[model samples]
Target: MDEVARAFLLPSALIWCLAGWFAASRRGLSSSPVFAGCWLLALAGNLSLILAAELLVFYFGFALMTFAAYGLVVHQGSPQALNAGRWYLFMMFLGELCLFTAVALLAVAAGAATALGLASYHGLTLGLFAVGFAIKLGLVGVHTWLPRAHPVAPVPASAVLSGVMIKTGILGWWRVSEPHGPLLSDWGPWLMFLGIVTVFYGIASGLNSREPKTVLAWSSVSQMGLAALLAGLALTSPGAGHLAWLGIAWLVLHHGLAKAALFLGAGLFQDSQGKARGWIGLLLCLPALALAGAPFTSGWFAKAALDAAVIEAGQGAWLPWLLTAGAVGTTLLMARFLHSLWVTPEADGLPTRGPWLPWGFSIVCVLALPWTAWVPEHVRDMANGPLALLSALWPVVLGLALYMALFTRPATAIRWPWRPRAFGPRAAIPALLPGLVHVERRMHRWSVVGTLFMFVIALLLAALSLRISGPVA
Candidate 1:
């Protein structure tokens, strides 16, 4: 866990500084007082995490980062930016409340001991912790904020938010649900279910998206799902859970760098031209492939560790296949993102200037990490094996085939069945704004949201009681 904190803090510091530089230059916030304030608050937030040794300290760090990010999101001050920031804050507060309540209950349950004590409260605390972090992770049902906030925020802020901040939520879950002395076996399956749902939902949403950043946002949603799956697997199998932590940590590190690179690269690609654009496109594939868990990359290595943990735990055979399918979906989404970058026309008269050094550094990190000691022993051993290689290869192959079939060809246009209009392949996916925005609007209502939070707490308590008691018979 200390290693996880260190891993995150290093990147948080790097990206936070870079993001501030980029936001000032890219978003024209150089003269704005708000930018300075957000920068300070965000720095304090990261410091809190680094200095934290206990629950309250961690919560304070989490809260500072959460609210500070709102300023980053709304820096543009446009209606869309404001709306996205509003939703971001709404979910942020809700998640904080859930985490605070759970931590408070946990401290009380420990009696004289602090929140770090290896004691388990019934399912209530575990459930609250899971849901709270899931909100931050942007897991399927609660993920409305992520896609909105990511696209609306300036490039660097989106990079850091996707890269570093979200991982804090995963860290919280690890501390709360995983450990030696206490077991929360019943909570495991529920988390696994959420992971599965989030994986597919993110892919589907990414496929449906038109904006490059929004597509990347949905990719984070999917990748975080993979993280949740591993965490849940660990919860069910405590012995292997410790080993699984290696996989989780690897995922966070590799994904954070690669995803950050891709987001930053997306910003660069927008205004690039001719030879420069071609070069950027080629560079883009490195992070995209890394993200897809291609063989020999950090993603594949981390995924191998996760797979080994799941197999060691004797989880059902279905999981390995599902994980592979999730990989295929991820590949498809990355393919779409790359395609969008390739085809979309540059903005009218937008300056060609971009932060090339940061993007390049990110690319370097993505390539360098996997080949080093970061690749877990289990992955290192099997990475070259024929079956293991094939398992990784097949998904990318299928994604490429599907991409060629659906997107590259001109004659393969399909009819739109759901909408009143008959549309071509280009128009296959309808705008997601209407339905998703409508749902977010209702969720933003203070009274209704407050009621929902209380209901979630009560429901978790009732379920915890039921689990604690024996069967009625």
Candidate 2:
């Protein structure tokens, strides 16, 4: 690796070390072995990436990171967590398989001259990379694992999972694909469709969730949908590359800081005794607003930049409306999250104050940083205008109105069958199995072996099919 590349990896490695030390010193080596192992594994994976000079190395690093994350998700040692972890692992492995298959195809097609760097391939390679990365990005139908996993993880872990880990997929997508066309050409519309579906589904599922954390998980799903839209725009228009990068960078920075703060605040609120403070409520709202692209916030900058990119690409016709709908959906989801907060049972016993510095600093960053640095002046000026302010405000208002009508109504008056009956042990077994339970269970103990076997089987099938078809005369 080059000196610059090694330097880039230094910070990640340091953070990994810090996390390991913290786990060991604070929790002890004996306690939560799984958690410690996962953390270490993630660290190792991340470090491997830094050291890696080839695509194979990168894939290996990513694998380590993902599996370790899976361990962390299930480390809390609950039945719910276990189930969630299984789902998480399954999705992650599926993504890995897709990525591997894509890489293999690229290598095969490109032959001996293929470069190991992400930028080496185009066309079919790009398609495979997109599918592989989209799985991790939690795009639409492939997103089922996210809602289940995020809510089940510990608060800190949830923060990292939602805020940081998912963004890696975005980074990967950016690295692998080159942008060189008009926006909305080729992959743009498809991504827009995926983004729209993800946005709506996330909001709907979030609204359906009774748990506060669960609602937040769905919110992450919704927010990433917007990120996907921005990414698609970048892909479609090479001219908008800088803007796209800026949008992604801002999204990553603001969303990570803000979401982490909110998740921590939720944990604090859940753990606190007596009445939750007015300040906690206010602090929580800040991140939610930022997420909804409120004026003067990082999200607004990202949204504006993304909009500009689409417009510059001459693909502005549908995106504005799509974005507006996405905003409204996000607002509704945030409203549901807030309502869940209000109704959540207060913890028993005296509340102990946790260290508030991290969350406080994060919230401050979300509110202040964008105004000073991230966004362009024109966009910022527009965000301050009446029309933009109204656009942002109306969604919150509509969400509030909907919440009052549907969620705040008396339980007796609502008559809905959405809530499933609590499962007994017998019922839970069937619930756990779903459709592929038996197959999954049989494969579970032999997961690595089974996975390898499946890969071989798939490759052989492809080869057989190719041979049968012969040369395309």
Candidate 3:
């Protein structure tokens, strides 16, 4: 696990450094001291997670990272940034409460704060950890903070927030919970169920959003769902759980780097002019397609591992098929992101060197990472297999087909290779925008969010109860 964390940490550090540079280069933000402070804070958070040997060490790291991200989110100090920061901080503190309690409970039960010691406790403690971490994972119902925060934050901040910060939740779970030894709780199926919900819901929400960053934010929600599914499957199958945990780690690394590339690329695309616009668009699509788990990409490699783990676990027939379907949503989301990028006006000035270096590095990393020696031989083999390649190809094909069919209107007279226009006249902006925003606003209210937090806790308790009670007599 530490090995896997190290692999993840390396790219994260590189990206974080790039993020600070990018933030510093932004026009109005150049003089702000928060960028450097937040960068260090984020750095400290990353180190704490990577080097943590004890539960307290890991939790402190997680907390530092979480709060430090708050500074980045509110860097702009606009109404939107302030609002997003408020919601983000609120959710962060609430999640911290759940996390602190769960960690303390594990420490008390096991008499030590090490992962090995904490694993001895029953699944109920795992459940607490899940509730706490799921906030960061942006798992359904509790995921409102993500879309709000990611879009409003500056590009560099958004990059790290989505790419690196979010994965800490899964890392926290890896540190404190044992999925491979014994099932502490029966939350595996529930985790899977919620994950599936998050996948579809994220697509739905993204389709409705106008901001390109918001669309990407929702896409993160969906990808995190895939990670959660991997985690859930791991928890349920002692035989395959270790393999599944590897898949989880790989998935986060794969998603983080690729998503960071796309976010940074989106910013670049927005800022490019003339030929640079077309070139940046092409660059942007590479990571976007990579994100769809297209063949030969890192997503393909990581997803193959996940598929193998699921099969090895004997989870069910439907899950793999459903996961394939998820690729379709991702395709649509990426397509929308691209289209949004296309229509937006390019920035007037020449592109900055700051984002280019890291963005290019990220793209290079995305393409090259899977082929490195560190990847397992089996994963490499699977990624190269004809059957796996074809399976990966189909979803992207289907998603493109679906995008053309849904977004374009059929010409009155059909011709050979009939081309369709992009987007329905009515579908240009989501019809549900006002309502979704309104709901999110209400959720931001202290009274309402407080209730929602309690509701999440109640749901956690109920899930634990159902697991403990088994079938009613």
In model 1, which regions exceed 4 Å deviation?
A: 10-14, 17-27, 107-120, 180-182, 411-454, 457-473
User: What TM-score would you give candidate 1 relative to the actual structure?
Assistant: 0.87
Regions of candidate 2 where Cα sits further than 4 Å from its true position = 1-33, 43-53, 105-124, 179-185, 275-277, 350-353, 376-378, 381-384, 410-473
lDDT of 2 at 393: 73
How accurate locally, in lDDT, is each candidate?
0.76, 0.65, 0.77
> In candidate 3, which residue pairs clash?
123-184
**Better candidate number, 2 or 3, judged by lDDT:** 3
Worst 10 residues of 3 by lDDT: 464-473
- Ranked by lDDT from best down, the candidates are 3, 1, 2
- Please give, for residues 227-257, the per-residue lDDT of candidate 1 as tens digits: 8888777877777787677788888888888
> Which RMSD does model 3 reach against the true structure?
4.7
Off by over 4 Å in 3: 24-30, 108-124, 348-354, 408-448, 456-473
What's the TM-score of every candidate structure? 0.87, 0.78, 0.87
